[model samples]
Target: MKEFTFTITDPQGIHARPAGLLVKEAKKYAATLTILKGTKKGDLKKIFTVMGLGVKQGETVTVQAQGADEDAAAAAMEAFLKENF
Candidate 1:
């Protein structure tokens, strides 16, 4: 498994548009992706689960990628977080 931590910079946090985009991005990978916020975890492929976390600005979240393409998925996820959040 591969993982990276990210702090949300967006004022609105992981709102609808980005959440949708995030789910879309997650679906591109063969690896399984999970987003962790404190003790809460949400499947990256699931929009409702992600939004259910209520990730807010200034909060740090960990993203884990596990499976065949975890390495690539982790790198891409990190880049995506940096660019978007």
Candidate 2:
């Protein structure tokens, strides 16, 4: 498994558009990906699950991946957040 902690930088936070992008990225990986906020965690591949966390700008969230391509998944997700959000 691999994990990365990132702060949400987008002014709109992880709204529908960003959440949709996240889910799209997550779906490309064979690994299982999860996003964590506080005590809540949800599958990254599911748009609703990610949006349900109510992530806000400047808030910290953890991205985790498990399975064969965990490292690539984590790196891609981290890169996505850093570059896009």
TM-score for candidate 2: 0.97
Q: How many residue pairs clash in each candidate?
A: 0, 0
For candidate 2, give the lDDT of residue 61: 99
Cα lDDT of model 1 by residue, 4-29, tens digit: 89999999999999989989999999
> For model 2, what is the C-alpha lDDT against the true structure?
0.93
TM-score of each: 0.97, 0.97
Question: RMSD in angstroms, all models?
Answer: 0.6, 0.6
Error of 1 at 25 (Å): 0.4
Q: Candidate 2 has which clashing residue pairs, if any? A: none
- Candidate 1 off by > 4 Å: none
For residue 81, what is the lDDT in candidate 1? 86
Find the 10 residues in a row with the least total lDDT in model 1: 76-85
lDDT of 2 by residue, 1-85 (tens): 8999999988888999978998998999999999999999999999899989999999999999999999999999999999888
